[model samples]
Target chain A: MSQKTILNDSHRALGAKMVDFGGWDMPLSYGSQIEEHHAVRRDAGMFDVSHMTVVDLAGARTREFLRHLLANNVDKLKAPGKALYSCMLDETGGVIDDLIVYFLEEAFFRVVVNAATRDKDLAWIRSQAAAFDVAVTERPELAMIAVQGPNARARVATLLSPEVAAKALKIGKFVAFEGDGLFIARTGYTGEDGFEIIVPEGEAVALWQRLVDAGVAPAGLGARDTLRLEAGMNLYGQDMDESVTPWEAALAWTVSLDEGRAFIGREALEQQRAAGVPREMIGLVMDEKGVLRHGQKVLTEAGDGEILSGTFSPTLGKAIAFARVPAGAGSSLRVDIRGREVPVRIARIPFVRDGKPFDAA
Target chain B: MSEIPGDLKFMKSHEWARVEDNGTVTVGISEHAQGLLGDLVYVELPNVGDTAQAGQAAAVVESVKAASDVYSPVSGEIVAVNEALADKPETINEDAYGDGWIFVVKLTNREELEELLDPDAYAEAIENEED
Candidate 1:
């Protein structure tokens, strides 16, 4: 049976095209995927991300448990309500999942992980927490909604309770706060200012309706994929998996190698860091006509690589992709599209940022 | 859903073949097909004068999600191809039954038209699919 989110009925009521995405019945789009993509870029839009799993770790040793479990150090989250992006890894230094952990207090930390990797992630977290005695509780009863764009926060603020709205407005980027029963976070997958609000499942439909009435466009997974891709955000399964490492996936910045912290996969990563990473993730733009797609062969001057995620950037008006190539590959490259070699230009990540395309040289 | 004009015959695979007054059959992907595909990002139409076999892959239609093969409904020689698709593939999504017609072909066997589905039958076929 396909899983249904708390907002499944709300999406259907909005005339969304529902599809089976990673076992969950999620909306692909309300109408036009391209229009939804543009809405998140130019105006405010909302997505029902309740399908993702939210796990709350609560115990006196919560901080200690996380410090040893996550690849990124949780020490940076000294301030309450601060959020940190980190990757959970296996013993071999491969990414299990990338997630956001919000530190509410010394005893409580809330982590949100990908839906498809929920089972494996939960098992890994539980197995690690067994030694630290941290209680890991999966919050499936909470529904998540991400409202994004330049006007996203303001629109969401208007729909939420005054107390919650006030606190959310003041929350810094990558921070989260709890007001009443709501967990409002100033974080999002789209490269836009927004809030990822987690509320009781029973209250989600009403909240979603309120946001829609507040002029937040109802976007779907289709737009979410395009927006995140253009933003240079990595999709867990596509960009990195058990066989791929954070260092090779252009996410080395997230990993902490502080001398004292002995986190899972730290040893392998340290060895790799000393030896040098064999592959590096790079952003590519198809200079010629043709949509760069995932699994398409990317032929670089140094060696060949495969596109991890590629799409026609509605904002850029052309095709762009994230490719895993040999380290030290130059700016110029080519990709095989339907047997034709299409010229590509290696550019800085985030083809678009802050509602505009990055200046290309 | 727009009415499939009676003058035009359709293939079960969701392609329409219009027999023009000059005895040529102009073929295009149906509106239903385009609606199902969502959006058309790229189209590869066969070259003019290329011989197309019935039920063969005559063209390629790609959307953001996946690529699909456009099959020939009738064996014919391509008389003309729609060059407009090269620059604006979205035209197929905008006007699948009219301006978005793929190619014009000179039919090899006019009797092959009998094998195609009528508008009502085609509609029924699609409805059955949803069930």
Candidate 2:
């Protein structure tokens, strides 16, 4: 049997089409997936992301522990409630999971990880925490709802007290503010401006209802996937796994190889960088009217590669994808979708930003 | 609640077939099938005059998640296809039994229609699969 979120029954009440994602029965869509996708791009949409695992790390040396555990440097988060996106890598430089860590204090940092990687992530996290004398506590009593879009923050703001809403809306990007029994983070997986709010389990359903009444469309995992893809966000399992490195996953920016901090995967990353990484991840855009899907063979100048994550972008009205090809592969490429070698152009990722098509460099 | 038209025949695989008065058969997926596929993004139709072997993939429909093969319900020569679906595939999700019809086939063997399950049988099959 699959696990159910606090909002599972609420989702069904709203006519959600549920699917077993990872081990949780989650909503795949409320109704028209395209409409939900458009909602996030244009106005506002809320997703029941309660299946995501939240872990709180507490100890005197929590910051030092994260410095050694994550590929990204945590020293950059000098201010409280600031979040950082990083990859938890193995000793061999392969990525274990990609996560968001919010530093509330030196002794306390909150981390949110993917639901599918819950077991392994917890195991790895706990094992490492024990050595650092840090307490790793899982907050299963919390539920997360990501209200995302240009108007998402404004819609969500109406739910909070006036002072709290003012502070939350004024919070810097990638920051969090807690008030009114909620942990509201000005962070989102979708490219849109929004909040990923964490609330106690008992209040999740009510909060969801308030957001819906505020005109936030009820979206699902389907819209979330497309939105994140357009934002050039990497999904942990599909985009990279234990056998893939951050460098090969188009996440070299996340790795910080400084002088002192010898992180878990630092040596391996340094070695790979010194020897020159053999594979590279690139973004794909198809102008033709066919949806590009995962596992499609991409034929490039240097060699061949498979698509990592591919989907139809509702905002662009075209197909977009991520493919890991040979390091020296040129922009001229063809993706063998089924049997036909369909032509595709390389695009700078974060295909859409702020509700419009982004020509990122 | 997806509708199962009593006059139409259904395949266990979810394709629906309706016989026209002119001795040709119209093919489309059932409402249940379209509901499962979510919103359609693209549709690949077989060419006119193409041979559609019964139970074989004669057309393709793609959603945001994945692409699905629309199996030919009966063996026939492809007489006409709903070309409008190439531009607006969501029609299937809207009126699957009517404007969403995929192709028109001049049936090569009318006996194949008898092999299809009736509406009641198809509904039962859907229930069984849902379990």
Candidate 3:
């Protein structure tokens, strides 16, 4: 048996095809997944991302705890409602999970982590928080809805209170505001202007219906995957796991090494940086027709590599993927699809931004 | 439920076979199969002169979600392939029974056709599988 979200019945009522994702009975799509993918790129689309775990940490040393907890420095979050994307690292510099940390108050901070890593993440956070005297609490009574696309923010604005609506829409990226019994954040996995609203579990159904009434097309996990892949966003388990490091996972920028903070995995990262990272992640695109799938062998001048997360981009009408390879791998690359050696080009990712194509990895 | 043409036969793997007047079998995935594999982006068809073995994967169909193999319904030499699907794979989702026919195979074993499920039996199989 799998866990279900507050909107499970609502999804079935709307004719969704359900699949087990991360032990949650999540909707894969309502109808045509390609059309759902287009809904996010061309107009507004809503995703029931309630499977994501919400955790609250409150204490006098909460801020101190996070600074030592995450690879990205929490000192950058000066103002309230500011959020930062960071990777939680293990003792040996391997990535445990990637999450968002929001500073809502001086002593109260919120973190959202992947559903599949919830148990281990909670255990790790708790074990680390014990020494800092921080109270770590999991908030299971909340649900998340990601409304994405060009018209997303404006479309969602019509449903909020006049006072909260103004500020929520005006908030900068990576910023969140709590209002009207909802937490609205100007951040999304899709490369679109949108809001990831965290609503009360009890009101989630009504909010979903309201968003539908506002013409926000109800998309599902299928569209979410394609949109994020096109946007050059990394999926947690596929792109990077506990055995992988941030430097090799195309997440070096998220690491802040300038500070004197002796965060976990700091020494291992420093040594790896000095020794030259062994592997690197790159984006690949196939000019010909064929889907590049995970675990596909990639041929490069330097050595062989493997695809991490690969998907067909509805926006580009082409196949795109992320491959992990030797750091010295050159521009020339080929992927083995069955028995055929198909050539692929390395594009600078963010293949699509602002709902348009840009030549990229 | 998808249309189960009484004139065609089906395999448990969701492929359908229609015996043509030319003594060849036209093979394609069922409408139910196409519906499950939404928005196909690519299809790898068997060669025109290739030999297809019954129950063996002869072609590949890929949607955004994943890739699936289209098994040959009966052993035969491939007579023709749907070359159009390489450029436009969505044809399978659009017309899995007509223009989406994957390949045509000249029967090498007429006895194998008898092993395939008829329209009524195929429909019942789908219902049981769905259940």
Candidate 4:
């Protein structure tokens, strides 16, 4: 049997097609996956992200703990409610998981991690915190909903109290605010203006219905994948894993190489940089009819490569993919589709942004 | 609930066959198959002159989620292929029974048609899958 979210009954009531995702019973789509993809690009769409694990760290050394825990420096986050995207790395520089850290105060910080990696992430954090004297608490009582699109903020505004709405709507990008019994963050995986609202578990269903009443379509994991892919975001296991380092995952920007701050995996990263990283990730586009898919072999002048994540872009009406290849590979590339060598162009990522074509990979 | 015409025959793999007046069989995947595959992004039809054996994988249908093999329902020579689907694969999702017909086969052995499931049996098979 698979674990289920609190919104399981709600998804079934709305006629969703459910699938087992990473050992969790989750909605694949309510009806049409394509329409759901368009809904997030053209208007507002909400996703049940409650499967993600939420951890709270509180202690005098909590800030110091995060500074040593993440690849990205936490000292850069000076303002309260500010959020940072970072990758937790193993000692060897392999990514354990990528997560979001919210700095609410010096002694209190909130971290949201991937659902599939919850068990290992918790164990890793606990093991690391043993010597830091910080308290690590998991909050399974909260449910998360991400409402994303151009009109997402406005649509969600009408559902909140005026005071909360004002504060939430005014929250800067990459920021979060706790109000009206909810933790509203102006951050989203989709390349749109929206909020990832975390509500009490009991109030989740009501909040979902209210969002639906406000014309926010209930999108499922299918749309969520395409939306994030189009936004040039990497899926954890697909794009990178325990064998992939941040340098090869196109996440070097997320790593903060402070002068004196020694974080885990810094030595490996430094060695990789000095030795010239062997692999690099690139964005691919096939404008023709063929669909680029994961595991498809890529033909590059430097050598052979493989696609990490691939999908059909609804906004661009083209097939897009992310591939890991030799660092010396040129822009010219071809994807092998069922024994057919199809020509593909290397495009800058974020294939579609703000419901428009933004080909900056 | 998709319409499963009484005049057509089906395979357990979710492909339907219609025996035409010219002793040829028009083949297409059932609506249930299309629905499970989601919105198709590409379709690879069998060549017009290709020969196929019953239950053999003959064509390919690709949706955004994954790729699926469309098996031949009966042994025959491919007489016609749906060239339109190469440019617009969503037609299979829109009209799986009508314009979405994948190919027409000139049956080399008519006796094989007798082995296919009728509409009643096909419907029951689908129900059994749900159970």
lDDT of candidate 2 at residue A115, scale 0 to 100: 98
Model 3 CAPRI quality? high
Give the CA lDDT, 0 to 100, for residue B12 in model 1.
83
For model 4, what is the error of residue A343's alpha carbon versus the real structure, in angstroms, after optimal superposition? 1.4
What tens-digit string does per-residue lDDT give for candidate 2 at A1-361? 9999999999999999999999999999999999999999999999999999999999999999999999999999999999999999999999999999999988999999999999999999999999899999999999999999999989988989999999988999999978998999999999999999999999999999999899999999999999999999999889999888999999999988878998998899899989999998889999988988889999988989989999999989899999999999988899997799999999988899878889732
lDDT of 4 by residue, B54-115 (tens): 99988999888889888888899999999999888899999999999999999899899999
Model 4: residues >4 Å from true position, as ranges? none
| Candidates' RMSD to native | 1.8, 1.3, 1.1, 1.3
Please provide, for model 1 over B79-123, each residue's C-alpha lDDT reduced to its tens digit, 9 standing for 90 to 100. Answer: 999999888989999988888999888999988889999899999
Give model 4's docking category. Answer: high
Alpha-carbon deviation at B43 in model 2, angstroms: 0.5
Which model is ahead, 1 or 2, in terms of DockQ?
A: 2
Q: What pairs collide in candidate 3?
A: A347-A360, A347-A361, A348-A360, A348-A361
Worst 10 residues of 1 chain B by lDDT: B60-69
* Residue pair clashes in candidate 4: A348-A360, A348-A361, A349-A360, A349-A361
Give the higher-DockQ candidate: 3 or 4: 3
Candidate 1: which docking quality band?
medium
Q: What is the lDDT for A206 in model 1?
A: 91
- TM-score per prediction, in order, is 0.96, 0.98, 0.98, 0.98
